[model samples]
Target: MELEIYQVDAFAEEVFSGNPAAVIPLYEWLSDELMQHIAEENNLSETAFFVRKGEYFELRWFTPETEVDLCGHATLASAHVIYEFLDYTDQAVVFETKSGRLFVDRDNGRYSMDFPAWGVREIQVTERVSDALGVRPDLLFMGKRDMMAVFEDEQTVRDLKPDFAKVVQLDGVCMICTAPGLDYDFVSRTFVPEEGILEDPVTGSAHCTLVPYWAARLGKDSLIAYQASRRGGVLECANLGDRVKIAGQAVTYMKGTITL
Candidate 1:
């Protein structure tokens, strides 16, 4: 079988500056095993597959090792594909996903996605979490799928050198270290050793937890965020009750057909 694929740089204004996600739009669902194989072969942080379903699309995201319930960059990339490549004329796109209905709105050159706010609660900072990150957090918050380690400043987050081997042993989906940004509202770096990602260049879903926490802490409804990964990325964030809006730009990097 031959399938067309697109690689998009999400949360970036240029190629090679943001997280890259593989997006494949299909007319029908392929077998789960085949999709997993394709994602593994691509070897990007996340690969998104979607099929049109009436007014909305059915979407799923896969890491190299497993399927995740929600992914931000990949979802942005998928919307980019739909708008730019799939001849979709609508300015708004709705996706039926494992996390329920997700909406992306396009205006001018940016895409804003509405995602569920992940519940976060203060947690005791264990030695395992501190040792894995190689830095003690000022505060620790536990989300549904990940943990947030809040530091005092941006330098603390940027200076971190995590022990991925140790991180893998710590319970939870992944770890995110964040602090008040020098230029933006906040800055963050994500690591997903359990999902085979030593470091995620730009994690959109992590912002779900970050947005609500920072908004409440900063006493603002809207804010700007930066993911301080090696590649780096910028996002416009807003906290609205139970939902968070994440906005960013995507640039297409490559387009090709994969043969299986």
Candidate 2:
């Protein structure tokens, strides 16, 4: 079997600066095992596979190890592929996903995605959390699928050198460390060693939690955010009580055929 694949750097103005996701558009669904193999071979943070379904698309995301419920950067990359390569003319694209209906709109060169707002509640800071991150957080919160650790400054979040072994032992799919940004409204870094991604470059889905938290903390509905990964990314964010809007640009990095 031969499948066309596109590698896109999401939330970046240029290549090599954001989270890279592989997008494969299929006419019909492939076997889960086969898709997982493909994602593992791609070796990217997330691989998005979608099938056109009338006016919308059915999308799924996979990491090297397993399928995930939601992925922001991959979704953005998928929309970019549909619009830029698949010759899609619609101003917006709708996706039916595990997380429910997702919408991505294209304005100029930027793609804005509407995602669910995930609220978090305060959690006790554990010794394991501090050992994993090498620093204790001032505030810790638990979200739907992730744990958030709040710091007082951006430098602390950026300077973290997590022990991936210890990080994987923590409860939740991933851990998010965030603090007030120096230039933007907030800054964050996401780690998921269990899922084969030690750190995510530009996490759009994490922003679902970050936007709401920062909006309430900063007392603003609109804000700018930066992910402090080695390959960083910037996001334009808006909190809408139940949903959040994350906007960023994507660039094509590679396009080729995958043979199986």
Model 1 agreement with the true structure over 113-225: per-residue lDDT tens digits? 99999879899999998999998999998898888899999999999999999999986787989999889999999999899999999999999999999999999989999
- Pull out the clashing pairs in model 2: none
Candidate 1: residue pairs that collide: none
Regions of model 1 farther than 4 Å from truth: none
Q: Over the stretch 69-125, how does candidate 2's per-residue lDDT look in tens digits?
A: 999999999999999998999879999999999999999989999999999999899
Report the alpha-carbon TM-score of model 2 versus the true structure: 0.99
Estimate the lDDT of model 2: 0.96
Candidate 1: global Cα-lDDT? 0.95
- Indicate the TM-score of model 1: 0.99
Alpha carbon lDDT at 123, candidate 1: 91
